[model samples]
Target: MLNNVAAVLLDGVHPFELGVVCEVFGLDRGDEGLPVYDFAVASAEGPTLGTHAGFTVSTPYGLDRLEAADLVVVPAGSTFATRDYPPELLASLRRVVDRGARVLSVCSGVFVLGAAGLLDGRRCAVHWQHADELARQYPRAVVEPDVLYVDADPVITSAGTAAGIDACLHIVRKEQGPEVANSIARRMVVPPHRDGGQAQYIERPLPRSRCDTVGEVLVWMERHLDEEVTVEQLAARAHMSPRTFARRFQQETGTTPYRWLLRQRVLLAQRLLEATDETMEVIADRAGFGNAAALRHQFVRSVGTTPQGYRRTFRGSQAA
Candidate 1:
């Protein structure tokens, strides 16, 4: 039923985010018996817009194009979080939702929706880096920081970058069917449905310490991931009492020793799955999970997907 689609743009729009919307909606797939949307790029500011990447985009379509769209997408921009949107554009967005049409936002584009008051009392997803700011800016909106996307019916919000693709395909699947979405995904060379949240992609850096007391023990732990060891043993290796070692480890690494080891083991398993053709049993043994079941359990907990699924995703048909 989502036959008409429009992407509204502003100055300083991020090209990749805009491209995601266009690629999903603008392309003609009628040759494969897929639904091809009546898609157009509308300019909110003017006919000519400057991209964040130093390129210019010119479109003949204006805000009037949105009047007939079944879905309106707001792609991310460099200054969308802080900059004010056109009053007319915001009003047009409210009208679109009022008429029962869906509106989706990619990354910081949620800020524009927030400004339009569409996010009030609605759950939304944004990039983790901007989560706090979004919550502070729109106190009424529920900001889901760790999710890849949130579908609140008329208003859908996605996290940064490739998450937008997931959201777009989700809309297609919901309206048309999995067959259509899967076919489109096949052409795009992306997973039909990715199994993970933003938590796995978030970077957690270790805090710098003036004097790293547990540095030597940390190195030893990395090299001996296959060997089972205890916190008491690691404390002894560091020449400190267990309590002091745990405290220092937390201060230096921002996480407990057990958690650090678990994460590293999962990362090692990921490498082996991606770059090697080893069997699950061998990978589990090398990563210190001891067995395939244990490896699967911990891998799913850490990576948000099964080891086999991850392997199939990364290695494709060559993962045998």
Candidate 2:
């Protein structure tokens, strides 16, 4: 089992990402009958290192602490994408992996594993903002830009800030079972597992040119996900031809109307599954799928797992 854990820190590390590791592994959750890891924070820079938020974190443990850890986590640093990692740190990471232990990275920390050559010929996940740079820097590594995380077994890499929580919980679920992971997530007040990929979150994050051409139509579509409306109907609502409305919708939303609506429906179904004890048929109707069978097909297609399987993983078998 994963009894020992270590978080290897470098200067300019993001505190929230580091906190994700500490919260999931370092805390004494024995009261909840969960495993209490033998956890430590090791500094690669020195006894004290500065953070990107204009603060400093001091730790007595050093690289030697990583030797006994079953899992080593590298949280993101502000400059990790461009900065060179210490040879000693890279060597320690490779040593742990060589010993059959695992190494996980949060966000830009994936660059450290890339530098250690661990990611060579492996598929990895990174924050969408840095995905291009990661690919440009490590040509041999396959970078997946839009997934919450990738489990390449010995090396797990995750996307942005919140994705770190998903990765850590995933590790718990994989090693300790769904019950422990779900209990911890309940205490943390976050979902035990998230559905869909980061692709859903990345669509049209930036604001369009203030013209608000299709803003009203987009809002209407969001409120009426259950309705089977065509582009012609949406065009009538927007007072434009079907062709012009479709083109403008694509330009403004960075996705087609049908695709966007489908993604939204999937997202809604995920929330209902996590937060409520709803039946599949009910959830399907509420999320625009019409029936359990249709919901199951679309849910598995979009989330890589069946509805019941996902509910069981996140909510435990009794709840499922």
Candidate 3:
């Protein structure tokens, strides 16, 4: 369990994501028997600074405070694709990390981690829109495109802004176990454990049908992720022809049925990979991958890393 926390703020800090760091680690949850961190909002500049939302936050410390911190968090900011990060900030980040402190980023803050050189030759995750730019910016860093987050041992990054909450929950689960994490989630009104490596699949707008077309089909498919679910079966369940069902599913969800199912299966596979000591073959069977080879192929294709690699990376990042 970490006792110290430091958050490095950028010029255009996204208020919500930064608030996540404040709420999760910076706040005192000790009344609930959870460990409370001595947290500080850190920057290279003054304690009083500006946010992207056109307001000022009263930070109490600077980057030097991170020297004694156990975890360093970077929240979302604007101008990630083109702007250069302050060199001093990057240097201080590297220095603290070199001393063995864990580093974390949410959303576009992955850009700052990349800029700090912490992502060199490391497997990482980021918001999808910025994944290409992160890869292009740091050629050596392996970017996981669709995951909620990726933990490359001492460095961790999350997807879009809200996914930061998921990443922080993962850290809590790692340090305090599933029960404590669940308690915190109940208090926060979010999922208890959304394994760090799960995909960030936002549900698309579906047709507002007078009939239960897409809704029924979605529920049926979720209940039967393991069973062989054919398009024909879905069509039959929806009482529509196979051709029409496929057409309507795509029109509603913006993706093919098979692709969405594969993503969900991949998410289940990642959870089993992280939470269980099961072998790849067993995890493959349970997660509907048929075999370890199939699981690896799809996992590497979708997450930019093998299942074992993802597990190792995330397990190696804790108390962050």
Worst window of 10 by summed lDDT in candidate 1: 195-204
Q: Write the per-residue lDDT of candidate 2 for residues 1-320, one digit (tens) a residue.
A: 79999999999999999999999998999987999999999999999999999999999999999999999999999989989989999999999999999999999999999999999999999998999999999999999997889988899999989889989998887777656887899989987665324442544554464454788887799799888889999989988899998977876655788888887798678777877899999999999999999999998987679989888876799989
Q: Supply the global lDDT for candidate 2.
A: 0.88
lDDT agreement with native, every candidate: 0.88, 0.88, 0.80
TM-score of each: 0.64, 0.67, 0.68
Candidate 1 residues lying further than 4 Å off, grouped into runs, are 195-320
Candidate 1 C-alpha error for residue 110, in Å: 0.6
| Residue 43 CA displacement from its true place in model 2, Å | 0.5
Cα lDDT for residue 54, candidate 2 = 94
Model 3 clash tally, residue pairs: 0
Better of 2 and 3 by lDDT: 2
Q: Model 3, which residues run further than 4 Å from truth?
A: 205-320
For candidate 1, lDDT tens digit of each residue in 78-173? 988889889999999999999999999999999999999999999999998999999999999999998889889899999999899989998986
